[model samples]
Target chain A: MQSLVIVAHGSHLNPESSAPTYDHADTIRATGAFDEVRTGFWKEEPHFREVLRTVEGDEIYVVPLFVSEGYFTEQVIPRELRLAGWDVSEWDSDGLSADQATLVAEDIDREVHYCGPVGTHRAMTDVIVRRAESVTDDPDVGEGFGLAVVGHGTERNENSAKAIEYHADRIAERDRFDEVKALYMDEDPEVDDLPEHFESDDVVLVPLFIADGYHTQEDIPEDVGLCEDHTEGYDVPETVDGTRIWYAGAVGTEPLMADVVLERAADAGADLGTALDDVRETTRVATGD
Target chain B: MAEPTSDATDEGEASGDAPETDPEAPEIDLPADAFDAVLDALDDRDPGEPLRFEGFSVERDDEGEYVLADGDSSTPLDERDLHEELSERAPAVTDWYAFERVVGEFGPRRAFLRWIEDADGETVATRYAALAEGIERAWGELKITATVTDRGERRYDVRHADDAGVPVDELEAHEDPLDARKLVTYDEKGRYRPLKTAPSLAGGWVFPDLGPRDLYETVETIYPATVANWHREREGGLDVTHWRETMERQSGIYGVVKTWDRGEGHEHVNWVAEACCDDSQCLKRREWEYDDETDLDVDGGDGAFPCREPCSVVVSAARKWTRLESEQPRTYEFDLTPSEKEQVEAIIDAVADGRIDEIREADTKEGANRYRTRFLRAKLFDDEGNLGGVPTEPDEE
Candidate 1:
């Protein structure tokens, strides 16, 4: 039987790291499509190889629920999963990129599809804008707000900030807000610099992580002067010095992303015909009961 | 059939305790010249004219103090060798290599299904493949089904494991679940690859069914201590005593993990943590077994730290635990010594009579206390299946 293996960076301490992954897996499973839809985490239950046990037959699909196609998606995951090929080459155009097709040993007759990270999808920019736009009364006609894309940048690798930077630029090009800035948790142009970089007092901070793990929920919020750890779909509010702050939950949890997932699976030979992007209806349609 | 293993003796019918006379122990009574009364009755041959008495097949009471039946009549046989019989019947793991291979490929739970499918019905192999209690303890019921192929080989179908009401065949026909953590970017050029342990991650095998224990949670709870011990061991240069004790309490099994050749190939184990806990990543911590022989190996074999009722910890330890065929298990053998032949027969009588605990509770000797505890670890011999032989499976009520 074919199995869909979702690989996420589960948390040892943060429940948020794995909760969304579990929720999404449960939703996708409700569709009754795969013989098995299981989540394996870097940190959580059914940790990596444990999830592999559920997959017995040749058809295996591994999707990294990562925000970006960086070190983890390319090197760590492929190496750990023993994916057919090295996730070495950088990806282009987001969903279902065949650019990273890794070769397996000759004995491996199984069909394995390694898909792209969630953040690179075209539909993702919409979610980021929506998170920033949701709290405003009239986003199109009224006052334009500043938006900050908070990512886990690195001191060692400049490439670490690529996805966040890319998403921030894409949103900026749209001109929906007065200003857009890319901030990092680890490197230059940090979140602390967001206030100085944007002229507008009403700035919204959007974490571009695949899930609201320790980083998005705890780290980013702490860095942005908020006390609460807000997750996906959460429209929680915190403000400082007349600047109203809106932390849209994780962009990866956007209902639309579920549709993107289906597209990626289909592109990998799952052959789901529909091209619909109604991921928002995932939970409602996926109740399975 | 052979005699089951007890905490002490590895030898069964050849056990050293048989024909000796110990003055310190009381002698058991048997009716003289009863024409092998006890032996013949226990081996009752004719099903058509089967013997039945007192709502149980018997000729005498279980305590064996008196014969309840005469020769052609019903009565208990005297001087029965019930203890040895029980000992012979305890669960003995006969095939270690095949068992490990199955577990290595299918994890613990699925391995149980494979065992049943291979054995036709559950045998000693499948019976203990799961928790000592088996499926009832893991999922509240045992419902593994098998379809016979034209070749007469059994093909197992494991659809009931899920609550979806979907059969295995149907799921396989159209299977693709979404990754809850994030969406997978699919690449047509991707080919299948076996998962290998990342050089930098913690890694091990997965045990299938862990009875009722949730091993992940168990690992989580003990993770801090393991990490701490890892540190202590790294600095303290590996304290075998402390690490062994911690492992025994946390996971009932003991084995080792070390520098391995990933190229040699491992069976179907799913995940491999990059716990690449090299000297750089991990230290002399609690989680690491002492590199006793400094032979951290690739082959995973298991043995007890000390025989105790296993909890989920053994499964955890088994993950990193491996063994090579050359090494032998440390087994102990001794003849049942003085002051206890009386106690042994009395205890057997209590057991066969169905009042073992009562008999045990009534006795105050520290020796009797030790005996009962040891007996508890003993897997009684059962020709049918040892899953039905022990006291730990779950109370039906």
Candidate 2:
């Protein structure tokens, strides 16, 4: 009976902005894994706060459907979930117990747990590399060509770009491509400078966003000078300092994204013994009449 | 209930699946009013019903228009009050607002005057004061008002040059005439008056039509490049279907963008050039095209021009857009008193639903004409989850 809440970044302008999360929820619901699974977006209705009120589950688990572990995951989600009130510092073990007792004594004891983002799983590399390869047309062989993993880095948290770097390093270790580098929209070694920094004549830029939006279309293209004529398919064939810089599609909407969500859910369940039972108990308590 | 296997059964199965999973249980029952009618109409649904209706519920024809049991006993659904109640309560949540804005704003002005039907041309003179206040608000503090009505349709309105009722020459000479007269207005004595002069601006909102499918399709055809550009940017694949539908709906209600031929007395085929630029970086026009060999310059070079220009001009390297041609100009201009914009927005919203034909005539009888020809209709469903047709048509009124 543990209800699953999938939090997505929705937009008032585009209905498709929330499509992937909705589709994932539908697919997960079809499996009959959880009693209730619902979606809410930051920008769209049934907003994040409203999403919390939607389900009657004693044990609620939140899974953020975001591309990076940025401000939304750390600040916005926690602020909206009302879980921050009970959350003591990580080192405050005694405070944790005090909070737990307060929860237990209350008429409705709600114990909430959050799972990691879909982008964190080690298996996500497969989807990324595949999407990169699918959009890349560079025939240059071996290790000479460069792979640039572009992410929407923020100034809020210095460590926000770690996820993008981790994926980049993972791909670099494989050594299939000559050099792999992590670039960002906001910070140093910017997306536009990839062509000059790499030794290879060909550079493949992949956007690590959940959706293709303003950054991918306007900012990225303006920075890297993507060919305005080439429409459909995420290949950028613009010349930078006489080098061919190619652009890859955003990673969020990959067909394998559904598999990644399932994988993350499974991984989160591994630590909790009798997870289904835990869900059932939590739901029963949460829905107390 | 045993799960059936066909499409109809699948739909029913899906609904039942959600209810079954929940612990709560309810015994389904046929209402006394719907019992015999449901049985009789089991196979006699209208041809237009299935194509245009989705996520709508049908109840007793509340307009009391339909004949039931040989016209012996029929009760009206009171759709007027129902619509009024809905418009008052949940106007924003409903998906039908898209069409409502489109059909309602299909007139002389791209903007629609609140809920009024067939009031075009000279009729606009009646709403001069109301429109003046709206213009003041929209234009950002102008002291303008309608004065001379020579042809009745044509208006000669003037705005005070300054907040102190000064003429244009008295204000800063460098400022553009239009910019200097931001939403300011004048009273009957030609004295400058702010919001205190006219409270009509405080009232209802005005709207523009989004248009029907045909217009949307044309605009889409014209702006395929822009559509593709938007599609390329989303993580979820760009909803080409929805985009096309949006454009068609916009075009139908807003009409087409073309020039008129004074000699031929017909709308001439023309293409509108849109300059897309990001002001954050430099204004470098990205894409540009021309359909005709006319000497058109898009760039209004230097000291502040509108984001869009009515005439062709050169653009910077950052601006990206293309030219699209149409068979003829479908444009028209009509003036609304003031509240038309809000009504137009509602009408456009209704038209965008893509389920216009399903709206029942009974449900929208009061606002049917204004709602119909220009606006599109969509059906609403009951809590029990039944298909209800649209309750009104524009032509009916």
Candidate 3:
């Protein structure tokens, strides 16, 4: 039997952080593509240590529902999953990218395939592009809009900025929008500097985050001058310093994310079984019908 | 059989060719396969003898083929028919090892299974029926329900006991057990809960359908190791590190706790237990004392789970109190009526018992009511906020 385990950084304070992981798991379970679909969190229940014990299938596919290939995806996840041959000591020296290749490990009796984060999947670019177009009512929304892809970047990990830049570059190459720029919450060219990078007065800020937690809801909105203080809901097309600022929700919250997760699992060599039809066939055979 | 003779005449009798028959040491053939192995375990019973084990009954037919049935049932069934029937009635009986693996061998799962099955007394069919109807049990702040699905698989539902009467649709549904971690982080008043086992968990959430493992994960997430620790205490294997030992092991910032040791007698430690380990403060029964030989005067609470040692919160608070106790004592004269002094004591008691929130603003008769306490502060305090217009520190004349 095959299983899919979606690993995400769940929050003990904000329930919204792990919402996408659960939503995607439910979507996958409905498909009946795998014998079992489960979720593991770094800061929550069925913690990384015990998540593996919950799996009954010998062949498992693990997909990290993170926005970037940074410390969590490369080091913490592999270490917590106890994936064989994962050396934490070599993390700094090797500078390994967990998304560079599919990590296959013989974890005791099971064969575990560690896939890349859903946010870094190539299909995520489409999700981001769709998010940029979602905030306005224009038939040709991208024709005069400047799309700013926002990411929670830190000097501690450059890969976070790289993921946003990669998506920004891909979106720009399509020339769907008038202008595309990458912005970060921590690094230079911060989200507040969105107007400085774009010539278009009509600018759209899309946070490349997994959920609408503090960053997407409070921090980004505050930084972009969309609100005076921390607020839950925001009205789009809010004017900021003469620039029409439109803010979209976090990219990971998009329903299309379910497809991206499956893509990540398939890329890591998971056999995407023919949905519930196979289950029905097996049941029929077992009952001699 | 030969009659035994005395040693003096036994040599001639032993050598005589009537094969020496020992009544006590008969060569009996051992059983083969699981079926016979079970019969062998029934001791002293002849083959084809009717047998009973809890819910199951076994008997031999006229052809000598073993037939099994429910203890309450009259129809005897062959092995194949029994497997088919039990696969629906009690899947655990058909696959006992698999069931055990799913429910786990330790902690609440073991206790829950035993409670439903009556610890080997109830029939498997009865146990399965009970599971189908669902057995609800309380684990700390959680109300857990264990049930068997149509497929005979065990499923669980976990919710705050306070929400037991609430409709499932009204409560937020969570699939991942991890959601409980977030649910228990704060109380109803939106204050952070420093102690997970405190009785102040918020309600209005339910994990409506969870596997046995997920149920364990959810309970563990909410209360950490309380289940395992409770089980360990039940099994008489709980290793408790009392206040004295736990204090001595502290280092750095917490190392000062050791200074307030047995030298001050167990009075201070008793106060510590009364303040921190009370059922009102925490939901764990304090198993630790001043030492293995010395027990504190304070009650250790009647919690379902045991606190094997002084938790970090207790130790940290002790360190602060140690520093405060080291200060030189000075008397500050405060003019107050006897009733005022009694009111001060009542305020402290109310706050200590966490009943401050329960006191309504309109309840002015209560000494610790919001308006009453405010009035007391207004009447007694000076601009510097000292009681009775007196300075806390000595005035440098």
Q: Which candidate wins on lDDT?
A: 3
Every candidate's DockQ is 0.03, 0.01, 0.07
Clashes of each: 60, 111, 0
Model 1, span A57-148: residue lDDT tens? 46677777877666567666665455554546535534223333434412233556777766665556666775565544333521567888
Supply candidate 3's per-residue lDDT for A97: 37
Write the residue-wise lDDT of candidate 3 on B267-353 in tens digits. 989888888887777777889999999999998876666788787568768999998888888888878788788889989989887
Looking at model 3, residue B164 earns an lDDT score of: 74
Which TM-score value belongs to model 1? 0.46
- Candidate 1 lDDT by residue in tens digits, B222-275: 121222222223345322432233333331123233222233433212112112
lDDT value, residue A76 of candidate 1: 60
The TM-score values for the models, in the order shown, are 0.46, 0.38, 0.61
Better of 1 and 2 by lDDT: 1
Regions more than 4 Å wrong, model 1: A84-87, A90-102, A105-109, A133-143, A154-156, A227-235, A275-278, A283-289, B1-111, B114-397
Any runs in candidate 2 off by more than 4 Å, and if so which? A30-32, A56-59, A84-109, A136-145, A154-156, A228-244, A270-289, B1-397
Model 2, span B1-397: residue lDDT tens: 1111112111211111212222321222222222333323323554222211112332334233322221244322344543432233221212122223222232212221221111232222223323322222111112222221211111222232133244435443221222212222233334432211121111111111112322222222221122222222222432122111212222211223222222332112121222222221112122222222232244322211112211112111111121223234443333443444454564555554323445566555423234443343232333333223322332422
Candidate lDDT values, in order: 0.43, 0.42, 0.69
DockQ of 2: 0.01
Lowest lDDT sum, 10 consecutive residues, model 3 chain A, at A280-289
Residue B380, candidate 1: C-alpha displacement in angstroms: 53
Give lDDT tens digits, candidate 3, residues A1-289. Answer: 8889898887656767777787777777877778778777776545564466556577788888888877777777886676777654433322223442434443333568777777777788877876665556443568888999989786757777878888899999999889999998888888887777888988888899888788788888888888888644557888887888888878887666777787777776778776434332322212122
